[model samples]
Target: MPTHNDPDTFTFFPVLIGDIGGTNARFAILLDAYAEPKEFPILATADFATIDEAIQSGVLDKTSLQPRSAILAVAGPIKGDEIHLTNCDWVIQPKGMIRDLGFEHVEVINDFEAQGLAAASLEPEYLEKVGPGETHPSLSRVVVGPGTGLGVSGLVHARHTWFPVPGEGGHIDIGPRTARDYELFPLYEPIEGRISAEQVLCGRGMMNIYHAVSKANGTEPVAANPAEVTALWSQGRDSAAVETIELFATYLGRVAGDLALIFMARGGVFLAGGIAQKILPALRQPHFRAAFEDKAPHSELLGTIPTFVITHPLAALSGLAAYARTPIRFGVATEGRRWKA
Candidate 1:
């Protein structure tokens, strides 16, 4: 646990940490160095006009803590001072957040970066094992998830430190390698004729699978959203919904296996985000594991790597708190200057 550091040790106090996604934004206040983050209710992104509005209305107004600095992990690419979400309409600017929100310092990072940091120190109780394998401390680890969008990141451990590597791996083209995929993927005409993993892995992606399954069956689609599709699968009443989830698990496993191989994540492959947590039962089925280990040339190598589902709800927030305490601990490269009081 990190105690409140001396002024010389850290430059901020009572910092605000946030995880903003396409669907919801979660806020928490770190009042002291060692205290747990006090979280507020999840705010729907569509309900607020801007990021500042969401923070002011949903966080600052509800809490008594006065935060001088804020570190937000947003669901988008972060370049310069502007952040434009790929899935949502909100645009975030760090300079504007400082000027209008009266913050002394503001830092924005890709949401999966935070998740990767958190993956470095997740407690055993917060994780549910997905397959058999061991996690080695000296090796690298990967975290991938599907929510409003797909997110991919990795943590590399070296010289007694963990470093977060963020990338838009989700945008890479997804190649079909199975019988179901051969039949299903053609139905998902690639976005601009090139299909990325996210197009068939995220929330909207699941809907695409559902619709594709329904069309293949020559039946009308029943569910209106991802949740409804999952509900139908959970009830075991709709064959198309069941097939949709089965495909989701299988494709996710393939993607995870590919990423694990790419990063050589011998430490583990952790599944994060809302969808993974909700669909754990489906993922545990044989289709997922079979696809994950189907890499013929490296099946033996992948079999040694563990896979898990991150069960902690506010993992990104916890990672931000860890970074705020000692930025060097997580070894994530962040850009921001401390504001003078």
Candidate 2:
């Protein structure tokens, strides 16, 4: 097997790009550098036992396209050969994939890293600005997504190349600020002993907040799941449900803002995931932006940094496609992540 030490010298054609999350695995084929990605139907991770099984049944069997290289963005940290997704049951072994699926090369990356790549490369039409600010080209940017789990990554422009920095930012600590927050926050269940950002900022996190809000209000929790809670909020029937989503947006803004400060994301802070796209009106409200700009010493700097929601459905694939097409434009570190046969 040949290791890819220099990203600039790396080359792969007929690439199979995937955005594998906890729930769904989306795949696409880039036949060549100039060809647009040909996407396959979204596959539920539960339907197939392994990543290769899903790809074979959902993608390879359906099309005549044969890809030589695979680029997968998974929802867990890329460490060693065997990759177990954080929330899903799928375990991705790149070398095993090369051995079983006949691929020449394989690259595995964190799911949010793909989101960061999308944020750096997506067009204006695919992004909806949440507040008033402008994007400073070539500056560092952050992408935060609240979904099955909270995903966070940073995109930095250095040495005339855009580099996506992947980390477990979702596991960062989060706390309450306001009086109402103080009352409700105590009710939230802690993972281990303390609450991380993912504890109150994801799909199950919405339920956590809902139950907490219900307890604080001394009301019975009516919503069964995150979707029902969002539905109740949308129908304007349940006050607790409303508070749940509101708190969710507020906390999301706070986290996004914190990441912005960490990276000094002057390029902009982009929000991805289904929740952000669903709660557009709530995110547009003053509360979200207010919490985001609450950074006291640098509130002015926060205000100048923009926040946006990624609207495109196949965003992660787009990012992989961009990197596949023009590898020189991105300085992706593939020293340990890339495998070959």
Candidate 3:
């Protein structure tokens, strides 16, 4: 397989890195392989016709240096050269980007995988602890979050290296595990008689939770969107919205805990994505950690694993830069296409 040359040796002073999501696309310039990345304003995905257009108008047209290599962490599944984003219409093609954008190398990967890659390297200020317990460096770490949809991935540590494994774990079936869970289940109709975790964990999930809670309490649902729900919850103006966010955090903790058990993530569980960052207070609630630690037989072990919310805006971009520098070290390029210089 062809490989991109070391970016540090390239004539271009900065390499391009991007994090594309349903709501916004963020681009940055990695001045050095290991230095802080310089980022541009977040571009609304609705404003652009294609991913290339966003990059061209937002980053390339504004910056002077010509980037030879690029890595984009997109919010979708990357099957091969062609990738379809989960929550938007943007389709990314690696070969087309290279041919049309004059890039020597271009790679696209799942957004959560990028978050997993950046989990270990995230600065202290960018992380906000959710529960207690220190990280076990030798064990795996799990990354899960909800934005346009829920994303799930894991990081494995071996031979002093970290490798990110991204997957569609959010589509797993979700059921009632507690009384609160049972109460919320009857509100929304399921897809094929089943409720995927994404149905109750993402932006739509929050709305579902709010509407369900309202119906259960004999009150008509009034919230318009997840933002409105969160805003109402923050201001303590809407009880139904508050309950929805509380249940959102609790259920998220339950899923995070389940994933931690699956991966034996003693290193930690990192809550990522835009929604996770917005609801830090809810995540810090006792119900959140309680649900996370409620697992039996291994509750002690679960208690030993710490959890955190990723507050860094450029985490995925940083991880892409890291992967660009040493793809083998990260071991994430096995599936995604890599254009060699």
Clash number for every model? 0, 0, 0
In candidate 1, residue 171 scores what lDDT? Answer: 88
Candidate 1 residue-wise lDDT, 45-151, digit = tens: 99988988999999888877789888888888777656888778899877887788877777677899899978887788988998889989779999998999899
Better of 2 and 3 by TM-score: 2
Ranking by lDDT: 2, 1, 3
Q: Show the colliding residue pairs in model 1.
A: none
Q: Considering TM-score, which of the candidate structures 1 and 3 is the better prediction for this target? A: 1
Per-residue alpha-carbon lDDT of model 2 for 1-341, expressed as tens digits? 22234543375789999999999999999999999999999999999999999988999999888889999999998889999999999999999989988789899888998998899789999999999789999999999999999999999999888889999999999998999989987899999988899999999999999999999889999999999998999999999999988999999989999999999999999999999998888999888999899999999999999999999999999999988888778878787788889
Native-to-model Cα distance after best TM-score fit, residue 315 in candidate 3, in Å: 1.9
- lDDT of each prediction vs. the true structure? 0.85, 0.91, 0.83
Least well predicted 10-residue stretch by lDDT in candidate 2: 1-10
- lDDT per residue as tens, model 3, 1-341: 33233443232435788889888898888776666677899999999999889889998899886777787788887787788998999998888888888787676778888898889677779889888999887789999989888989999998767878889999998789888778879876576888989999999888889989999999987789999999999999989999999899888988999999999999999998778888998888898899899999889989999999999877787667666565656656543455544
What is the lDDT for 77 in model 1? 76
For candidate 3, the C-alpha RMSD (Å) to the true structure equals 2.5
Clashing residue pairs for model 3: none
**Pairing residues by index, what is the TM-score of model 2?**
0.97
Model 1 alpha-carbon drift over 4 Å, by segment = 1-11, 336-341
- What value of lDDT does candidate 3 attain over all alpha carbons? 0.83
Could you tell me every candidate's TM-score relative to the true structure?
0.94, 0.97, 0.93
Which model, 1 or 2, shows the larger TM-score?
2
